[model samples]
Target: MESGTSSPQPPQSDLLDVFPQKGLEPGDIVVLVLYFLFVLAVGLWSTVKTKRDTVKGYFLAGGDMVWWPGLFSVLMLAWIFLPIYIAGQVDMYAGAIFIQQSLHLDLYLAIVGLLAITAVYTVAGGLAAVIYTDALQTLIMLIGALTLMGYSFAAVGGMEGLKEKYFLALASNRSENSSCGLPREDAFHIFRDPLTSDLPWPGVLFGMSIPSLWYWCTDQVIVQRTLAAKNLSHAKGGALMAAYLKVLPLFIMVFPGMVSRILFPDQVACADPEICRKICSNPSGCSDIAYPKLVLELLPTGLRGLMMAVMVAALMSSLTSIFNSASTIFTMDLWNHLRPRASEKELMIVGRVFVLLLVLVSILWIPVIQASQGGQLFIYIQSISSYLQPPVAVVFIMGCFWKRTNEKGAFWGLISGLLLGLVRLVLDFIYVEPRCDQPDERPVLVKSIHYLYFSMILSTVTLITVSTVSWFTEPPSKEMVSHLTWFTRHDPVVQKEQAPPAAPLSLALSQNGMPEASSSSRVQFEMVQENMSKTHSCDMTPKQSKVVKAILWLCGIQDKGKEELPARPEPVIVSLEENPLVKTLLDVNLIFCVSCAIFIWGYFA
Candidate 1:
């Protein structure tokens, strides 16, 4: 009789089995992170005061934002979020062909390079520099994405032909007697089961989209830009721009996968063993590798380098943003709160030191991430973020909008969400093993989505429930309520001058005795008033006379009013010639825009 029990299962591969043997060279690793550090340092150098005194200055560059740099922030978002995500899809497709080559090395190194560039500017020039750099990065990334799409479409003999080829391939695979064939409407249906399906419509709509809102809305990296806006209008405009950019992912990520289905059908076939054994025993291994393999195989040298640079730029923008925000939180919330009276110079010193320490910690942790295998990188990063995010989002939203939430509730809710999410993650990791053998069986991806949704739901419920219970059980102090009231109110008087003059005087007297009167103070005060009067007189003379004359003229006494206006000393008039170069640049910009519009319209039509 055949053995009731099959042969003992193969020993499980190490969870870190995906790490490439070479790893990053020590020099390369240092250079990459250091480059990012240098960029951040440039931004940090622009910060002249302690973070406490210049919280807005440090975080938002005093809100004197420009449109171009704002555009960069938008671009940085794409650069940071899309490439790895798209690359992951490509790799999955390639894995179907059993390809051994992975973009792990490229991705890991690019991340390091990005970190280096972003860190230097962020640390030195602060948000201003980061924004400017982000703007440039954004343009580069857009061009790259568009170029990729154009090239991919042309290469695949246009979208229609590619779709036809894909369905034909799918049709060939259907069972002979079962009458199973690719549906004309859903030719791209790779996986079919609903409940067990990983990328089902339900997952995308219910699982991913809601979580993304919490992420993009409340996540420090993204929201930091909004907080830095010059006004509500700018903030809202920037957010809308980001939303528009988000819709570009379908063109950039999904279409590429479909393109690969036609261009590299063999890659998918080789993913299974029978094809691997029959056609080529040495399978390429996975479909995820399809993207990089296509890049390496098809794209020319210059374009390849350009695309690679775009990817690196994206990674850098995100890494720098994360590093900066993390450092800001640690230095301000933890360090400064502990040492509230620290001097500006001393705090700046502490900030720099904190940045260094955080970089070291991130470097150490990044290796662990690099070594992780058998899942999409974007999904993995986002899933982890979701677990930590919901509680923070909940507390912040509640604290911002609700009056009853106390600090205790916020703290406990965050802790509870993190603990529960982590417990679920650990259980899933242990019990629901990563199905590395079956490329189509995306256990990690499905589990991650499940974990994120459940974690968010539980986190939201816990935060509201705990905050409500805590509010009633241990009510917030009157002082805390007053503070919350001050933050919420839009009244200028309440915001600018909450305490009366007497209160300030009393507090000042308690700290130090009133200063003795001095002759120098009197002289300085008089001089300041004289200068103010002169400036005010200069501004009002012409406008005041014009208004008076107009009123008198309406009453038929214009000549009499003009005579009374004491001969306003002939207003100093200075005329300056426009720079020829400035005019040339404007003309050139107009021409470029028109040309671009014409070209696009003609091509599309």
Candidate 2:
């Protein structure tokens, strides 16, 4: 960040604590620094390999963007938490990793350093660097997780042994207090009490699914990876990879968390606020600390260092993905809108600079995020998304499928839904949840109604308002909605209408439907077009110095030599594979993924 502030400490007031307190040893520090260096090297290498001067190269690598399944987003979570919380539509986990942070380390060091490394690689190599580094990060995460998983299974015996002991622990906990605000009797079950449980069956299966869909399917951060892939086969394979990886988290994180509560019930399942404060300094039980604690207590010193690197890897992977994607949205979508005539080089520079500003904003938000929901990091994120994201999900779904959704209806619907969501968000912070034993002072809707349930209500309200307003207003043109909605995605007629071949720049400069142009307007238009050509063209090589050439080489900016870039025509791509063998494999993998999902739900139902 811009200022040297105190690093965030592990939750002292309310998060759960388990590991024997320790500082970063010399080995850990060395390993972490080395890992950071490696990531930086990879980014620089990628920058050399991939084009980066254009928006597409920087944001999407040197390939086409596509429509990837939401499952694709959460693929890395099992390795790092199986994108389960992410698949489950959890928010940024930079804060989650800090729940059981190391002793004597500044929170800023972890958060800021992570963001800075990611930004360097992103700004240097663009999306190519991020993807390759993510691959390495995913590998490290799985190795670290499996190491902890092995230790946990060994510590508790096998699955059957753990289950037997888990039941015994739950029974004893119940004897102390049936309603002890500790781990629930149905802790292992996915379908819990509709009103009392943290994740009600109805909410998990239905309400939470809304925001989850938006996160996986529509969110820019996750989709950016897919868009960088070479073709439809590669994208589908990548999503299948996610599904395959997802099957491991319940084993990697969830079961390990259960084992934590069973083994260290006093810490993970603390019932009294005083006892909890003594344990993790947070009155909330410390399930979030389970995985980290397992690593610290079980792994040897070198392995501990490796796991630390893995945790850092996970943190960096996520932040980089988010920062890069956010910059893309800001530079292309928002910036381009504001300055429609701005040059491509200007867009690239602004995008990189925007990442630094985002880093500062995140650093500032850390304190506020830490205080939210009393230190339940993942849940706080999920609930906020519950309040704000369902309406966006509804709008996206309708805009694509229902051809009548106009800009006015979409814009107004967002404003209306956002206002209501914000009211709930503000009230949540102001009238905070009371201590476990104390009476809740908040409104019934705030206190009693689950945020997931609120999401459904908000979604219905948004959809109705949007639909009604659209019905009374002008409809979106067929061309406007063409190839966007599900029904129209495969229509060859609409697809053909979407993209036209490029014409000579001179012809395009004066080819607007209004043929009659004033002499002054024509000259001004040519001047603007010629200026754009100069900014993008490499014809200035004879006048350029060594420093500028070096900067261009390092950033992977390929000069256009003698050829000017044609104004691109975007084509609607069919994501399904055409190759018989690959298509068959994809179909089978998809079926297997769905089967696994069904099996998990049924086993826990």
Which candidate leads in TM-score? 2
- Whole-model lDDT, candidate 1? 0.49
Assess candidate 2 and give its lDDT: 0.68
TM-score of each: 0.61, 0.82
Please give the distance, in angstroms, between residue 509's alpha carbon in candidate 1 and its true position after superposition. 18
- Over the stretch 336-367, how does candidate 2's per-residue lDDT look in tens digits? 99987566667887888887787777777665
Each model's total of backbone clashes: 61, 14
209 in model 1: Cα distance from truth in Å?
Answer: 3.9
Candidate 1: residue 157 Cα off by (Å): 2.9
TM-score of 1: 0.61
The numbered model that scores best in lDDT is 2
